[model samples]
Structures are given as C-alpha cells and as structure tokens.
Target: MEDMSRLDNACHRPLRSAAALGLVAVLTAGCTGTDADTTTAAVGRAAVETSPLPTVPPAQPASQLTRAEVETAVSRLDGVVRDAMRRTGVPGVAVGVVHDDKVLYLKGFGVRTAGTKDRIGVDTVFQLASVSKPLASTVVAAAVGEKTVAWDDPVIKHSAGFTLKDPWVTRHVTLADLFSHRSGLPDHAGDLLEDLGYDRSYILDHLRYQPLAPFRAHYAYTNFGLTEAAVAVARAAGTSWEKLSAEKLYRPLGMDSTSSSFADYDKAADKASLHVKTGNTWRAEHVRDADAQSPAGGASSTVRDMTKWLRLQLGNGTFEGRKLIDADALEQTHLPHIVSEPPHAPAGRAGFYGLGWNVSYDDQGRLKLGHSGAFALGAATNVTLLPSEKLGIVVLTNGEPIGVPEAIATTFLDTAQTGGPTVDWLTFLGPIIKQAAEGERSPVDYSKPPASPAPAKATSVYTGTYANDYFGPMTVSAKGGELTMQLGPKKQRFLLRHYDGDTFSYRTTGENAVGLSGVTFTVGSGGRADKVRVESLDTTGLGTFRRNG
Candidate 1:
C-alpha cells in the first residue's frame, strides 16, 4: 500500500505509485499496516539516495500462460468479485488462487458483518494486516532452515535489549537489516509507540529513542523496525514468536488456519469483523490488537489458510510432497534486498524490498513478488507473486482500505496478464487510494483554531509529571475547566484543547493516528513549566517533555 513509486506518500511518503498497488496505507503505512517516513535513534539522517534494481535477463523457460490461460483467468474471477463488491462497499472478501502447483481458487464475498446474515467463508478468519509480512518471512525462512537464524544475523546478535540511535547502527543491525526496510530506522519507527498503548517490550525498548537514516542506505516501511527483526529472529530460534510461527511455518505447511497469534486471531471460529466506513455503512469500527506488532502487524489467516501458503510460495520450499522451507532458505526470501521505490525517472519503474517481500521486476523479466496487509483499522490484505509464472493471488478484505484488495489483485493479475482489465481498476485504484490516504495526514488543521486564542496558564501552570525518555510519563491534569493529557503505559487520556499561546490540541486516537496533535509548553522560572512540545510525539525531533521536579 505504500509504494507510490517514490512520488512519496504511503509507506512513509513515496508514492510514484504506492508500491504498485498492493497492501499499504496503515501508519506511515502501506505494507505491515502501511509504514515509514519517520527511528532507531541518534539521528544520522539524510540517507534515501537509493539506486540498485536494473537487472533483467533470464525470464524465458516458457511458462508464462496456459492451463487454458489459468482457466480463463479463473472464469473472470466471479465477474471480478461481483464488480468489486458492487463497487467498493467492501463488507468482506476472501480469495485464493495458485497455479501450476494446484489449488486453483477458493472464494468468499461480502457479509461477514455488514448488516449481517453472516456469510463470508473460504473459512473466514481475516486479519492478516500488513499481510503479516510474507507470513513472517515464512517463519524466518524456517529459522534459516533450522540452522536456527542467519539471514545476516546481527539484530544485536539476538536482541540483548537491541539498540539503534546508533552505536555502529547498534552493533550493525541485521535479520536482513530489519527485514529490508534497511535499518536507518525512521519512517514508522516504533510506530507511535504502538499507537500510544505501548508494548513489544515498550516498542522495542524505545527504538533507542527514535532517529537514524543512513545505515544500509535508508528506505522506510517499518513496523517496529520489522518488529525488532521479528523479535530477534524469535530470539535466535529458541522459540516464541508464537512458537516460531507454529514450529517453522504454520505447523509444517498444513497452515492450520495460520496465526502469529493475536490470541489466535481472537479465537477464530470463522473470523472477519474488522469493518470501518461509517456514513454510507460498514460499521464494526477498530479492534486491531496486533499483538505488539506480532512480527510486524499481527498475523491471521484463511483463504483456506492462504492457498496453503500459495502452495508453499510456488513450492520453492515444497509444500505437499514434504520439504518444508529451505529451498536455499526460501531463495533468500526472494532476492532484491532494498530500494523499495526509488527510480523516479530515467529507467523509470523500480521498487523493491524482498525478505518481508514487496519487491518487483516484471516487464518480462518476471520476478514480481508482493505484500499489502492493511488496517487503517479494518484490514485490506493482498498478495501477488509470479515467480516466473508459478502464479499466485490472495486478497482478503473486511472493510476500510479503500482500494478494495488492490482492485482484486489488480483485476486478477490483469486478467492473468493481458486479456482484459487494463484500467477501471476500481476506477483506477480509487484515486490512488485516495491520494495515498491524504499523504499520511497531519498537515495541521487542529480543527481550525488560532483566531485570537491565547489564554491558558495557571491550570497550575500546566499541572505536573512530564519526563519522557521516549514518551514515558506525561500527566498534566486540570479537571472542571478541563486539560487532561496522561499517556503511554496505559495512562492514555489526552483532552488538551486550548490551541494558541502555550498551544494545545488532541483528537488523535490509535493505529498511528495523525489528526489533531501539538501540545507545546516550555515556560520555566516559577511560571512553572520547562519543556513539553509533543506535536504528535515529534517525529525524531524527539517530542520534548522534561520537567519532573
């Protein structure tokens, strides 16, 4: 969802095309709940130069199209999923398909919870928000094929309180540099401390106080910097990233209703529920738990356990006849390590990320790969693979992600690669997912304040508490005439309001919410204040706080 090809907006502001339309638009957001554009501290900054991705040659072995052209693009995908659910009223959708290797397609559409007669089943259970990053990179490529952890190791050699505001990029960051968001760690770093509730060991122990952008040469899409590299490759595989993703890849590929565990997608029994729209309908509003970034945006499955993991990722690691993950460690989670959307001109189309996969390559060279789990508080899942035509598709949806499952996997892989659907792709991607979700918001409207506003002081000159070694304590108080604030470790609150001299505002609420913001303060010497700031927890300026005594 956030590849905007570098025009800059989703997945932290680069939308020349929104990573060619997959899952994005969540936080800074796009994949893993649409992410980055803003952590892992000490702030070196200025990095995003980008480069690689020119390679092409070798896509010829002859399997691009057949089996009656993939059963005539699966008989026009139930009329393109009933005309994209009669045009974006997305109550529910589930789809799965795999080719050459089998499982042709499973389906489901609408009504998991809209007005309700309950339906939606290709075995229901939805929440794969941020498409749980390539299903937690196939459970860290089956713990690097049981050698126990090695995609370039180093997440402080297995999370000894992992750091990053630098210290040599915290002993050289790895697990493929935060699963290819490249450890420059900004753009969704520690995601607004998990939208203020905070956990995942207090957002990976405060991404060493947010800031960093020049290590493996910056890109951004971070979901707790890939959940601190999948909780340090599940602490070097001893276990518990939901039991190493049910013992190395969903119980050896039976995928048993998948699950990196948000309490097993809140006790499944055919799940769905996420919804959001509001006025024209879709209701079930936000319940996104995401088990502290459960390996980056909590996992959940079904499209019949994601087409048995798309037949074990086009069977490179083999699924049904045995092997279970280690086709040279899942071919290094499909190559292309970084540059996720850079080439804005000359040679044009570029984009990639691999090892948690978004990657690209097409114009006949083939490769492709993708990711797009979303949840601006609902869910919008997606997947597309080509692997030189073993072909693939997944599209789950509950509600709130406007581009309805990336226009049904781009009109079912452009009608299985060119027989139809070149456009009207959900009316050409619903205004590029409503202009990359209004370019990740926060342009500062604060509902419109500043017209002779200024009179605040003596709410005990802004009450007490404050601290903040990365959003730790906050307090404020006030009561009757009203002020509030509180904060993380479940203090929550946040009423504020005022908006002028000592500045104030609030309205924000969850999933990396970017709405009202600003809090300011700064007073000092007996006026009783000494630093406050907060503007949506200051993206790397580190959001002030101070006081304490």
Candidate 2:
C-alpha cells in the first residue's frame, strides 16, 4: 500500500489532515463495495469491516522457467519502462525482476535528474519511503526469532515511555497491533508534530494528547504508531532501530547498498535525485531529512539491494540457503492481522494488512504480497512478491505523484502470469491519473459564513504567539498593514488576508510553500484574540492554537 502519510490528493494539492482522509475515502469507496459503515463488535469497539479475503482455490503449482523463457518474457519490460517515463515524465527508474529465486533482470533507465547526463544505475540509492516498513518488520521478526521479543508483547513492556490518550489502549497495544496499523489513531495522526520539527520521541510523548478512534477497532495507517513499534523492538533487542535493521537484515542478506540513515544517503556516491513536476517540467527537489522517523519510512536502497530483499521475502526469511529467521516467524508477518477498510485499487480478491505488507489474492487467486513507498514529492517505489510463483518485481522512480512504479509492477506481474505482456500499463493508467488530477482541482465550499457581519478588530489585537502542545508555537505578526503567521521550528511564514469576520485566507510564501488555506481567530475579552484555528488538508480538525503571549 502507498504511504497515505505522504500521498497528496488527486489534484496534487498539499496534503493536510482532511484532504488526506478525503482522498482515502474517495479512493477506497469502491473497495468496500458499499457506503462507509461502522460496526460495533462484540469487543465493544467500533470497527469498519469491509470486504473479507476471498478463499483461495486449490493452489496451482507454478511451472519452472528456463533461462531463455525468462529472458523472452522480460525482453519487453525495458520498452515498457521507457514508454512509461515518456508518458509520465519521470526522470529515472530502476527495475528488478526475480523469478524462481534468481535475479532475472536488474537495470536502470533514464538519468538521475532531468536534463542531467548522469544515469541511474542498479546501485543508485533512492529513499524507500514507506517501503521501509517491511524491512523494519523483518528486523522485528529477527528479534522475535532470537526470543528477545514476542509479537504479542505489550509495547510498554519494551518501551516504558510508550503511551496513548486512553490508558486502556496504552496498556493493551502490542507490537503486532503497531505493525498492523490498528492503534486507533487516525491515519498520519501525529504527522503535524513531524511537520513542526518534532522528533520521533517527542511525537510519541505527545500521542497522549491526540484523539483516538477505537482501540483495535479500525485499521488506521499511522507512521507514528509504526515508529513507536520500531522503538519498542529496538529496546527489546538492546540496539537502535537503524543498527538492528542493519545487523539483522541488510548485512545478513549482503544488501550493502542499503542503509536506514539519511547520513548514509548523503555519503553515497550514487543517489537518485528527488524530483517533482512543476508546470510540465520535472524539477529536482531538496532532500528531506527523515532520520527522525527512520523506523516508519526512512531507508535508502537500490534495485540491486532490493532484489536481494525480495529474494529473502520470497524465501520466507531465508537468503542464499541461510535461514536468517525462523520460517514460522516470517510467515506470521504475512498473515492478515487487520482488514483494511477502503480497498486499494486494482482490487484483489481480498485485501488485508499484514505486519508490513498488503496481503491479498490477485484476481487469478494467487497470493500477492506487496507495498508501495512514496517519498514526499520526491520518489516512488514498489516491491511485490508472488510466493506461489516464486516471482517478485521491484520498481523505483524519481518523481512525484506518478503511478509509473505501480503500472510497471502490475504489467510485469501480468506478463509473468500470461507468458507475455498483455497490458499497456501506461495507456490504462494515464486516464486515471488525469481524472484524479482534475477531480482534485475541483473547488469545494468549506466556509460557513457568520449570520451577520461583525466589526473588524484592530490588527494589533490579533498579533501574538499562539501555542499548541504538539505543534509548538505559532506567531502572528502585523506590520505595515499586513499580517503574517510564522510556524514554530520551520518558521514557515504565510501571508494572512482577511476574508470574512475573524477568518483570514492564508497563503504560504517562499519556495517550500505548500498552498493556500484558511485561519480563524476567536476574540475573547479585552478585544484580543485568545485562540486561532487553521483549516488545511493536512489537519484533522481546526487545529486550535491558544494565545500564550
């Protein structure tokens, strides 16, 4: 599954809390085959149970492929990737295919950056984004294999600092729950904290103030929850998450090009430059430091290294005849722990969430386990394995909001199944992308104007420092008849233009500005605004900030 945390809306707008939820709702509405329904389970939690996993018919054994057959089946993939790049304007991509536990094809196409001659290679490192989840889960699986931690153990047992708003949830949430994304927090619940320059530890500490859904009631994909789980695993293993992942998975599999640290990415000789499309041009993007949330989506790797990782996954924790983890422990990560509410597209027979993978049966009744990673407006990645066929494919691209990786994955899987490329993936996906972009740009009225016009307050009354427990300080300053609000650590300043009453439309300035949103100030006694509320796609609600000075 794509990391909802980083995915923008169909219109390519800056993703806020509401837009993120709305996008999920729109995309997943077809997944459930019905309206959004919430059910109260016998366990006293409200859960949304949608389509259940389809029962797999008796397995069909896959045929062994000769080297020639594999070659013939994959000969068209290069053309496919090249055509996709031409269609989507993606700068560079690395493709890898593993069949029957052997790397059949691993190559790179296009240049590392637009208008640059430097080519992406098999070892060109790119941020794995949410794809880091499975790797982190594998490390935890290794810890489980060592008897250092049990999957069902409460997170508090390992990390005493772990907590949530509800005492019961804090006591009951387990490592398994965290991996499966069932911690009750909404999707990307603590992302604002990260946006405010808070580290993982601070984010975890502030989780006690975030609202909860239902404990074990819904599948909310939360990067913060996963980060906490990784911390718990690290604590149990007596090592940091990065160190544990390296020792347990990367080193064991000889994935020398992979590292969970951005520092390592910076030091790498060959790295794919991040890119985003702006006005029909693919522009390089600044690298984001994600080391603070490394456990959730902070790994950099290459197609060469990813193929090895895929081989291990297809081998059920074994790589090169070495059993790095117990087969049963590895299998547990693939088992469905939570039923995802909105079905992801190209709907499989049944969609479910495993520890670090999306477990579902393809339309052909083959078990398809995979995950897609998206670096915020930089890179896109996909890794898929069909254990029944001993087939896996990895596609990595340097582009924002593009479906090329997914298109490539699906086309490759289809080719493997039919012995030929039966799908024009670009042709099929182009319209969908266009339609999403159009739909996202459609205007929506979110304003509820006051019944009557109120007197305008003095500009000085609205200027002050407002504080949020999790997001830190926001200062509204007025000078020369203009008002601006500066966010905490990032100090992102947005120009505020009065709209109606105390509400003002704000547009971010500078190169990193996301987009326009609205903010409302609530005036109290003494004609001074005591509270401010912001409306944006990234926030779940108003995100009230109180006047502290």
Candidate 3:
C-alpha cells in the first residue's frame, strides 16, 4: 500500500503564515558637554551617546491607491499573473482585486483547459473550495443578527440528532464552536465516510465513533463541524444552506454568478474546466461534487461575483448602500477565536482561526484575513483581505497542487502597497510547488517486490464476505488464481496481489473506489482470515472489517 500518512499530511497541513518583510531603521544623536568628572565617567558618557544600535520603527500603515496608481498596479499585476501561470503550468486563472469600495482589477488569463480554444473570462465559474467557509459563516451571522439563532446556543438544540464521541462535548458544543473548528473532532475525521457514499446526516450521526481532541484544547480543522453548523443555520432559517446563502448573501451582495450547487456549475455557460498536471502537461480531471459537504467547501463562483463579496467584507456587512447584516454580528465572524500554529509566519505576527477565516498579521502589523482551498487534484483557490487597508484579492486556478495562487496573492499585496514587487515570490515558492507536484505525479510505487512470496495459508482461505459499519461491505473471493475484493454498492473490484506475510495490495480500477492501496487480513481459527484492514485514500487509520458468514 502507498503511504497514506504522507498523502494526508500533504493534502491537509495547516496553512503557513505570510512571509516577513525586511525593514530596518536607525536613530542616532550626538551630544558634546564639558565634564568636570573623571576620565572614566567621560568615556562612559561618550560610549552611551555615540553607540549606533539598530532600531526598528513602528510599521507604517498601507496607503490608499489613486486612480492612476491603480491602473499602473493592474498593468504590472497582469504581467506577474501571466508569469505565474507559465512557470507553474496552471491552465487558467481568474483574479479579482478590490480596493475599498471599488474593484480595481477583475480579469482572467490563459485557456480554460490545456490544448483548448476556450478562453477564460472574469465571469467563468470555478469551485471556491474552503473559501466557501466565510460565505457560509456570513449566512449564520445573518441568522444571529436577526435573532433567529444565537452563537452560544448548543448545537443539539438546533440539530436534535447531533452527537459526538464524548457525551459532554455532544451536549456542550456550541454554534460558535462549530464555526471555530473547536468541536473536538479530529481533523477531517468524517471525510472517509463522505467519500464512502454516506450523506451529511449519516456522517453527522457517526461522529460519536470518531475520536476527539479535548474541547477547545487544540486546533483541528474539520469540515464536518462546519457542515453541522450550516445544518443548524439552515434549520433555524427554515431553508437549505444553499437557499439561505443565496437569499441572504449572494443576492444582497450582487453576487449573481455564485452558487452552492453542482447542478448550477453544470448548467453555467461559462465555467472553468478542472485540470491537473500529468508529468509535463495539464490534463482535464473530474471535479469532485461537494454537495454532501456544501457548507464546508462547495461554493462555485466567478471573479466578478467575488469582487462584490469583497466589497461587502470591506464595507463591514454593507454593500451598495444597503446594510445586509448587523455590523456587530458580522464583525464577530472576523474576530479571532483560537490561535493556530502556522508553519510559516511573519516576524512578530501570530496566526489565528476566526469564525470561518484564517487571521494573521501582515509585515506592516495590520490584520490580514484569508483562506486557501484545494479541491484534491482539481483546482486551488485563495482569498486575501487586508481589513486595515480596505484591500482584498482573490485568485482561482484550474490546475493545481500549485502555489501559484498564494504567490500571486502575496505579490499583489506587496505591489499594491509599495507600487512594485519587492519579493521574489516564484523563487521562494519553487521548492514547495515542486514538492507538491512530485507528490501528485507519484502517488504510489509498486516497483519493489514484496518481502514475502505468499499468504500464510491457501488463498482460498481468505475468500469470504467482510463488512464495516460505516463503509458498508466488501467481499473477497479467489478468481483465476488471484484474490479479488469488491466494495460497497458499486461492487468495484480490484485484483489483489500478495505483498507480504498476510498483506495484499490492490490498484483501484474504478474512479470512485479507493486509490492504489493495501489490505492486511488477520488469520483466525482453521487458517481463515477473520479480520481485514485497509490502507487507502479514504482513511488515514487502518479500517477493520470483520468476516461475516
């Protein structure tokens, strides 16, 4: 089996903080005085007065952009973005930049797919991924503003079926805790359930089986927690999360092209095709339908639409002369709720998780809020907001595992503030991007032969039906001198090859089935394998299945 631990680590590591800016300042003064004291005293005074120690001045606030400056910045941004696409091999990208109440730049570049004539435009829809979190949180904020729900209300009050592994946490988890990712569930705890054809309700009910971190003790990014919160918001509002977001946020902010449904994406005339680089070329890839986890990361939108959303954020919940939500309630979503350990961070700046956004400080010591989203191999999206400067930028790319979005956002931020690029973003991000690309290219290695030549007993002894409560069923049988396993309702079958002692490996033949993986079967009485464990993409831990009949 491929090492799934590395894949999990690569896909879901906590986002790094912004890079630190280098600034230096010095202060010096000279004083000459006739001293009647001894020579030692005079020497001490001179030493203290003339020493040239480096001092750092308080960070200067970012300046607003003028019309002419905005034009120049956009022109420069166009070149930088195109350069990023070329260097990263991203098929297409759409960028939006909002400064205060105006959108200074909204445009797209390159073709929507590799080896295609379809041109990308500002209105082309792309999956927003985790960037959808803030939008969903905004809907919940609206519910709070209207007194339909309270942030502190126990989740069980709204969703009667809600439960967690711990009885105390199940009873005590709050709406705010859900949005803050502090519900105690491990990171991506129920992701495999979702991948195994389980519905949202089914996944929520099975949360009690998953392990938990101490409540609010540490940060564990979970999509199910947010999905639970969205369910509660929808229940309180007497509408689905999709409808609530549309009526409350999308329409109010004039984001007409945004949607929370995959159906809408299919019907849209202008949409970006999802792509993934294979070796040296970009190829089309299937976009995973996120309807089951809509609230967590399932929104699709255009740059033009997102520019309007940015304006509302900069306006503090108001947009186009309308106050869509109470300022206080909306601000609550932006307030830091828990500190996060970012792998990379600016000097003297710490990172935190707000209601739905990752909050950090810029080099200028100003609040910077943003989120990045990766749709497996499909795409990568990034949204950055500098509240103090009233600046926001959104970048969506069709081909990923690339750092193009982050590099572009950082470059835009630096350019907008200083009117020129001060960082070598591409060079700095090259190694990281290369590492991610290599991971994608080589998901599994099957070249090396297994240490053991055969199973403990005859292959026929392993043939039987195995079942898991959450994943449904798997039947093992010998066919043509090889062991084969069939999974779930689809009955997707993969030919198993003996890897070692009691271990076997299988390469998934169906797209929806688990990827190249391995399984270990434990022999019981009479040399029959009674228990089987799987190591695949859907699970980080070994999932055990017991022989049934």
Candidate 4:
C-alpha cells in the first residue's frame, strides 16, 4: 500500500521453439500430507531448449493432453515471456517449470547477448544472482548436518572479533538474526561486493572498524553480515564456503554443472552469457567471478542443475537416498523467527524470516517456503514449493529491474496449482496485493517529545569520490548546507539534522527514512565531520557508507 509503484516490475523477454516430449512419470492430483508417499517422474526428451513444446500423452487424467494442447501451453508461456521482456526490458531469461516430479517444460527466450542472436538454451547458465541466498541457507543447513554449528549460535561466538558499534548488542546477535535480515541493518543500496572489491579481507576489516546498528530492532537485509556468516560457516567447518557447498549440496544432488563462482562455469564449455539493462535494452557484460562473499550472491548454474535443487527442496532436504541434512533442520530454517512490518514481515502470521529463507503462508494457510535474490544485471531469482500442493517453480533471468522474476515465478506457481485456466498474471496478482495492502498507517505524531534537529554545520573535511572494491565509486557533494549522494545514476539528498549524537535524516522525509535516515558525521579530535557515515533506511548490504573522499 506504501507506493507500490516504487516496486514495479522492471524487465522483459522473447520466445523460442517447442518440441514433443515423452512421459517419464505420473502423479495424482491431491493435497500432499505426511502420509503421502513420494512419487518419481521420468526424464522427458534429451532436453528441449525452446518451447511450443511437443506434447507427450498425459501420464495422469489430470495431465493427459494432446501435443497441440502442450504446444498451446508452451506457446502461451512464450507470449508471457515476450510480453514480459518487452515491458520490463529483460534481455534474456531461462525458465523451467516442474509439475509433480517431472520437468514438464524448459525453454530459453531472447539471446545470450541481446543483439548477437546467440539463442539462449535450456542449459544456459545465468548467474543465479541473489538466488544464492537459498543456496546459502542450504549450506548452513549442511553445517548443521555435519554438526559444524547450531542455528541459535550467536554470530559473535563464531567470529570472536565480530562486533557491532554497540558492545552489548554485538554479544547478543545470533546467526539466525544475520541470515534472516533481522539484524536491524538496512539494504545497503549499492552492491557491497561490487563496491568493496578491495579484497577478501575487506568485509572483516570494515566490520572491525565500522559501527553497526543494534543486533535486532528492525528487519534490514545485510549481505555483508551474510557474507560474514558464510565465512564463519567456512571457518567453523574448516573449509571454504564454495567447497562446503559443493560437498554438501551440489555433489549430493548431482548438480555437477552448478558452482559458487563464475570461474567454475568459465572452465566449463557451456554457460550463458551475462547482460545488463541499458536504456531499455539488455547489453552483454563480462561474467564476474566472486572471490569474496561467494556465499552471498555468487552461484551460477543452468536450469538442468537447478531442477535437481528443486527436487531436493521438494524432497524436504534430501535427494535420492542421502539425508543431506536433518529434515528437522529444514523445518527450522523455514520456521519464522521474527515479526516485522506488514507485507514484508519476517515469517509467521504474515511475512516472516526463516533461518535463511522468507517463509510466507499462502491464502490456504499452507506454508510456501522461498526467498528472492537480486544482483547487478540479474534479479528476483527463486525456487518456491508448496509442500501441500506438491508443486515447485524456478525462475531465472538475465536482466535486473524489480519484481519481474517474482511475477513470472509466482505466475507459474499460480498456473501450476490452478491447472492452467489462463489467468492474466497481473490480474491474478491484484487480489494478492489487495489482500496484502494495509491501507496506509496513520502518520506518527512526535509532538509529545519534539525531536531536536542536528546542528547545521559544514565539515569541508572530506568531499570527493570514495571508491570501494564492491560498491564502486560513490560521489559526494556538499553545497548550500546540504549533502548530496550519487551512486551510479541514482541520487539522494539529505539534511544533516541531529539525532542521538551524530545521526541525521532528510530535511523533509519523516519515519519513511528510519533505517535509511541516520547519516552519521564522524568527528575528529577537533570535533569536525572528518569521516561521515551515510546510513540508509535499511542495512541489508550497505550498513554505513564511510567518508573517504
């Protein structure tokens, strides 16, 4: 309800060929319960890269269909992609749909490179982007399986040197709080890894030297904390996060093509190209390998490998015969641990956070376990399953805007569950949004205790382009007693009104800037804003932007 326009979908795609596939397995349409037995589905054809799929005879009365019907379904999906791409500026997208145990459809639309005509294939390896979050969750679960750590372990316990600006809060911060984004940090607007590409040690060094918010007060997604958590997991297990991921996840599930870095895919013969949105179009970009924070958003893979991951999640933390992790750990990871504001709540009653995933209840009150991730040029990738519906969906795309991935992924799930009656994706989402709309809450009246505005002062101490390895360069300008910030193309202005000691907010914006508002002016012995720390609304990735100009 709070200006949904800011959260609009940002990209689009095209369509490809279709093929006939063979039936591999059969499943009955019924709500799955604990008593329900797991069923196996078959491997269709070699692998259809394009859609307008050749239909195989239905294995169940519910799925029985003529080739034409299957083609029609695939064709409809093609329109969905074409329209989505055109509307959202998505350069390339690869989609995989699974019904029951079978991957009923897989297709790529557009091209690996926008103008090169390198047609995307089902096996195209797009950076899973933030899709790495769920995978990270899996790694944590594996650590639990190996008895490497506990969910409730305080994060400070794992890394003795880790601390927040507030000493007491640092000791209380838990691993669950970090991964779940309940660490009270705001989403650092720019890419932490992208900007802070200084070195692998930069994150730790920054944490040791920087100040952080209280451990748990609000929900702000922090990739930095998560990356640290990943490092902690690695250190605890005496292995790198990537190796642990491969051993505990990829190897067990036979996702040989999947990896925690782009280098891994580069060594392989087949992988999709990376692209970025430019002036309403997707342009080719060099694939990046994340040496630092590999667990945050560095995993890359094809639809084929991802499907195996889906199967593992559907099987409740197991694949084939291996109990990769305790089934209870899966439940624990999915259990909502914190309450948050409406629509974006943590995990229970409404929105909530699981250990490393976002757990939401469907209209039917059944649990839908999933998380969404976004990185430069890619976004909103997710794998979601309704254990009750026995359905799962994986949506991956090449361009990053907003909501595009969620729209497609959620649409697929809606279609799969409804058995495809052809509902407009946007129209279908309307009711869900309406249901989620809390109408605006009344504005807070702070008259009882009038807030004291920060003293107006200019510290010409540092004002220049500050560059970090992950976030690139941030330009700061001080003029007319106002400070302005420029990151890439986006710009924001702030008025340094006082709060507590050194914090301030936008001149006019109120609580809307809570997590984002507090801009702290670091003082030197002379009492000047020598090193200013720019705090945003929520500390997801970027907690405090330090002044180095």
Among all candidates shown, the one with the greatest lDDT? 1
Per-residue lDDT over 1-549 for candidate 3, one digit per residue giving the tens place of the 0 to 100 score: 000111212333221111101000000000000000013223323423422111332353665445565566667888999899878778899999888688889899988878989999998998877778888888888888999887778788888888776766777777877787766677666666665566777777777777666666455667778888888888988889889989889887878889988789778888888786777888886766777778877889999999898888888888889889877777777766655543332433345667777655543455666766666446677787877667788988887545677678766765665677665766664445435323322134544555546644688788999878767788998877889888755566778887777878876431123345677789988679998987663343427888997
Ranking by lDDT: 1, 2, 3, 4
Sort order, TM-score high to low: 2, 3, 4, 1
Give a tens-digit lDDT track for model 2, residues 31-58: 2221000121223232223222222334
Tens digit per residue, CA lDDT, model 4, 419-516? 45344543433233222221222133222223655454553543555654334456667776556655532333344443444544443221111222
The predicted structure with the larger lDDT, 3 or 4, is: 3
Q: Return the lDDT, model 3, position 267.
A: 84
Prediction 1 TM-score vs. true: 0.37
Lowest-scoring 10 consecutive residues by lDDT in candidate 4?
A: 16-25
Leading candidate by TM-score: 2
Q: Report the candidate with higher TM-score, 2 versus 3.
A: 2
* TM-score versus the correct structure, for each prediction: 0.37, 0.85, 0.84, 0.65
Candidate 1 lDDT, 1-549, residue by residue in tens: 323323223455312122334222111122211121124333323232233222333443456677776778788998898888887688889898888788888989878887878899898888876778778888888888888877777778788878877786787677877877778777766667777888888778888877777777667777777778887888777667888888888887777888877887888777988887866777887788878888766888889888888888888888878888888777777777767666556755556677777755555555667776666666777787776678788888887667777777766776666667655667756666656643355667878987888787877888889898887888898989888889888788989988787888887776556668788898987797777888777877887888898
Instruction: State which candidate, 1 or 4, has the greater TM-score.
Output: 4
Model 4 vs. true fold: TM:
0.65
| Ranking 2 against 4 by TM-score, winner | 2
